[model samples]
Target: MKILANDGIDPIGKKILEDAGFIVDTVHIPQDELINRLNEYDAVTVRSATKLRQALIDACPNIKVIGRGGVGMDNIDVDYARSKGINVVNTPAASSHSVAELVFAHLLNGVRFLYDSNRKMPVEGNSNFGGLKKAYAAGVELQGKVLGVVGFGRIGRETAKIGLALGMKVIYSDLFEGPISLKLNFTAGVEVEVPVEQVELAEIFKQADFISLHVPFTDKPVIGKEEFDLLKDGVGLVNASRGGVIDELALVEALNSGKVSFAGIDVFDNEPTPRQEILTHPKISLTPHIGAATNEAQERIGEELANLLIEGLKK
Candidate 1:
């Protein structure tokens, strides 16, 4: 079996495939260029940087699968891959803790205004504890705050647990009606599950003290200008899902106007990079979609995908 691998995949993953006599080809080229070489390999693997579009899958007839190293398949063309008899497998459970940690980090960063404080802290000078103190000076407490989770997916539910543990009321807003089927018990936590109807998206905006994005919506933006207008004062926003879920232009305006107090962003509409506007925004705590950037996660993803591809090719 021949595999064309993206450079960022786990090293152990590459070694295992290579050692198994699979001709593993690693490249750092862009997706367009990679598409040209796809015909030469039996399988193609990537994380989020490459978009496994319909055209790419159609062009490479010999390919059997496209392995995703992380949970989200937003970057892949699943329907087209299936039509082509290509197996699409991802390591969904591997990055749970890694991404969950990011949510906490971003949450704290947004509440405390860490991004702005860190930038001004002089790296070379002996400026005392000025920056440290300033960073904590504006820090807000999570206790007794209303944390509204937009989706009850793996990450969303996990995040809600943390919120509940922190003495905050956890209200989940999923599309489905009634209570969430997944049950949990917190040693020092309480989750007050609420249906999406209890509070509309607008209510989520206007009432939530802290709002975290956990669902995947790429075609249409869930929150926009009108949504922002309805936002309650001093709301902390966190987008760990696809960036398109929130209208960037609308969010930018809201941030500038102080309508949104803080933001913790991980994903973007565009992958492998971010729009210049968001990077320039100082009020946001931005990560380059490193929610699942961990050694353990990558290894598991690589092994799982490799096995799946091998088995799929045999079938």
Candidate 2:
């Protein structure tokens, strides 16, 4: 069978496919050109860069499967693929640890004032940061802080473990409105309770000292001007979740006025490179959506996606 692996795959994964009697082709094909080339392959694999829409799938009468190399399927048209009888599979576990690590990195940086410190800034007559060192350093100490996680999925669970080890109390808020009984309960100074349902937006803002977000993106912004207004000055809000989850312009305003202590963002509302103003913002600690960009993670994603495609083909 022919497999078109876009965004490429690990050398080991590519070899495995070749040894399995499948011909794998790697090309960073542009989306517009995908329909023309897709019919040549039995399966097509992709990461976020590729958009597998209805039109492209319709062009590929020979294709039987669409493999997603990562967890999020926002780029693929799942409903259309189902109608076409194309098996859709993803590498869900591939980047579990990679994303977890990025969350911890942000938590530490925010707590230790890593983002706010720069003697380099002072050299340019920007004494602002040096003067506000106290405010930045005042960020809640994670060791004893109450880490209120909004979700308890893989990345959320991993982050909770780290918070627990770091001596922070971890409680989560689940949307389904039912209690998730944990293997172990935490009632250390903070109350040990069921993850609150649709936590009063104001409550999250007012109480959380170091609020790190792990929720997925929706069409609307998660934290808007109203949410920002509820926040106690100097509350560190970190977004490792999808972009557009937080209002960027509002965040910038909060940061400038010392309402926000620090912002640790790895994703953006607009990606594959956001606009210049957001990237160069002085108050935000930014990354190029590298939440799952580790070497080991990429390999696992490629292998898992390949397995799904191969298995689907067999059926």
Query: Which model scores highest in lDDT?
Result: 1
Tens digits of per-residue lDDT, candidate 1, 1-315, equal 788777466777777776667777777667668667778888887877788888878888988877887778877889879877888877777776577778889888778777877775666225747656755686789998988888776777777767766777777677765354334464578545432323456667767998888888856788887788887888888888787888888888889999988788898867656788888898889998888777776677777767766666667
* Per-residue lDDT of model 2, residues 1-315, tens digit only: 899888778776787788778999997778878888889899888887899888888888899998888677888999889888888888877887688788888878766766655533456335565556545555556777766666567676666666666776666655655344333354675533332224544566667676767777777777888788887778777787788888988888888888987788988877876867677776777777888899999888777776777789989
| Model 2 weakest 10-residue run by lDDT | 191-200
**Per-model C-alpha lDDT, please?**
0.76, 0.75
Instruction: Identify the runs in model 2 with alpha carbons over 4 angstroms from their true place.
Output: 116-140, 177-202
Return the lDDT, model 2, position 313: 90
